[model samples]
Target: MNSDRLFTRFAIGINAAWLTLFALVPIILILIVSFLKPDPNFFVLMHFSPRSYLTLINPIYLKVFARSLLLALITAGCCLCIGYPFAFILAQLKTRFKPLLLLLVIIPFWTSSLLRSYAMVILLEAHGILNSFLLRWHIISQPLHLLYTNTAVLIGLVYCLLPFMILPLYANIEKLDLRLIEAARDLGASHLQAFGKVIIPLTLPGIISGTVLVLLPAMTLFYIPDLLGGAKSLLLGNLIQMQFLYTGNWPQGSAVSIALTVLMSLLLLLYLRLIPKAQRSQPL
Candidate 1:
């Protein structure tokens, strides 16, 4: 028995060590590289310098970072507004149909997000089906400039991240005790009051989780912004890509990447702290 226990301990230690090496070490490497000076050849130096971070103070990069944050916040808000209703509906579904409904929610994920964004490009173009239909219906005389704008970027982002927001909410809402809602009604609380006080509070943790999931990726996403925003509304992700690929500034790119990672970590910490401890411990 002692030998078996010792072997189990050794196995767990080995797995933990492997994970630290593979994941933690690379992150540390990036942090270190971010502080290093860049050589003319674009390779990072062994010695550390603050120059890369200094470059981040430039107005252009600052604006891009701010825009990225705003876009992410809006995307998270949109997802919450839309996803909550869908999740609520799914929660009320019959048991026999619940799995099918969930499968439908997950089906779009099987296709690549890039493909979906590209499809949006085709649909939202000036002469695309959406604009043509609207024109034919006399909604407007001219095709709207829907593609290659910030609005298009937001639409694409919301489309891509909707599932992430919905699934967590559905998980929580589906397990909610229907009796509690009825009990609130019995206590003379109106439907709106019950939902606002009881139902919304109960689902807060899931909402927070989904917000973090959607916000983090939305902030750093490059493809949708590049395709939909027309490369004019530059974002931090685009700046990072340009630094590495276009400008051949590896250290600067590494610095931007590190900053982004740190910002995301801070946002996630804030989000987690907003959750009440009791709700966090609740069973999903």
Candidate 2:
């Protein structure tokens, strides 16, 4: 009994240490830095100031924040629309072939996300394969301008975040009790009614999980816009990147980072409230 107790305490201690080192420490450091006065030559001054947070209220930065929020919402919505149907189909597959279908979903992840974004660049370029094929079929008199547009950025985000949406949805749908659907049907629920009243309620957790996963990353993945949408399509991620890397404004960058983290936390809390009280108490 003592040995098992010791082992459990040891595991807890290790996890606490890991969280302190990786999560808590970084957040504390960023919070501290966000209040520091930035110096162009020295990076930051020891003096405490709220200038970094004050700068966030500027109209230009507010616009960027709104744009990032809009893009993240659009990306998450698109992923849900695409992923739900795909996940439903996947869940209906035979047990023997299910692994193969899941493997296909996982295949694209083997390559770096940056590499995948670059590949989109090639495909969306004016004279790229899509446009060339369209022109060959006389679809248009000239190649369409597909790259360096909001559409391109949306495409890249959807492509990158699709897997995050699908995996959670598939897990939830796979665990659904089909008998409950049949019972609902026997009660005179039509196909759409059963789906709306039964399947959707049961799968709500997965939908929430997938949306949170896609939305958080979409808000911060600046590279997709940089590669596909160009400088004209700057988002909050780009703003943060420019502050730290090019402008050497650590305080402002840290402030942005903290703001984003807080926003995500609040959003997550709101999403949790939508879950059933019982489910909220259970493991995700």
Candidate 3:
């Protein structure tokens, strides 16, 4: 028993050390740098200043932040709507077929996401396969302007993040007690009613998990907007990248990063608090 306890403690210590070295240290450095002043020649100076944070109050930066938040919410909501039905279908499949279906969901990971984004670019272009097919079918007189738009960026976000939304929902739905759904049906609850009242409540955890997984990354995926939305859809991720890489303002970039991190952390905490109340309120 003592040996088991000692081993567990050692494992925890090792994990803590790894997290401190990689995650905590980098976050601490970024936080510290955010408070420093940027130099004209150098990226930042040793002195402290609030200029970076103050600059965020500018309407331009506020617009970028708002755009990013809206895009993330839309992407997450789209994923949830598309994924829920697909996950439900998957969860109802036979055990023998389940692995194959899951493998199909995961097969996209073998290819680079960059490559996938580029593929979208090709498909969404004016003279692309989709347009050509539509033209051949007399769907439109000319090729439509499909690429380099917010719609294209949304397509990329949904295609990439759909799996993240589906897998969690499938896991949760697969474990659900189908008998409860049957009971609700027997008690005269209609299909939609049983789904809304019982199945949804049981899958709330998975919904939250999937939303967080998709929303956070969707907020910062600059490459997707770069490839699909072009300059017209400049997002917060692009703004931060420009600050650090192009403009050579590391302090401002760090400040933006800190702001994003704090906002997401607070949102996550709010979700955590509300989830329990939501679950408890549902009639089980």
TM-score of each: 0.86, 0.87, 0.87
Question: What are the Cα lDDT values of the candidates?
Answer: 0.89, 0.91, 0.89
Per-residue error (Å), model 1, residue 113: 0.8
Please list all clashing residue pairs in model 3, or write none if there are none. Answer: none
lDDT tens per residue, model 2, 1-284: 99999999999999999999999999999999999999999999999999999989999888899999999999999999999999999998877988988999999999999999999988989989889999999998899999999899999999999999999889888888999999999999999999999999999988998899899999989899888889687787888888999999999999998999889999889787876766544333
How are the candidates ranked when ordered by TM-score, highest leading? 2, 3, 1
Decide which is better by TM-score, 1 or 3: 3
lDDT of 3 by residue, 55-139 (tens): 9999989999999989999999999999999999999887797898899999999999989999998898999988998999999
Structure candidate 2, residue pairs in collision: none
TM for candidate 2 is 0.87
Q: List the residue pairs that clash in candidate 1.
A: none
- Per-residue lDDT of model 1, residues 63-85, tens digit only: 88988989999999999999999
Clashes of each: 0, 0, 0
Task: Give the poorly placed runs of model 1, Cα more than 4 Å off.
Answer: 1-25, 135-140, 276-284
- lDDT at position 133, candidate 1: 93
Off by over 4 Å in 2: 1-24, 276-284
**lDDT winner among the candidates?**
2
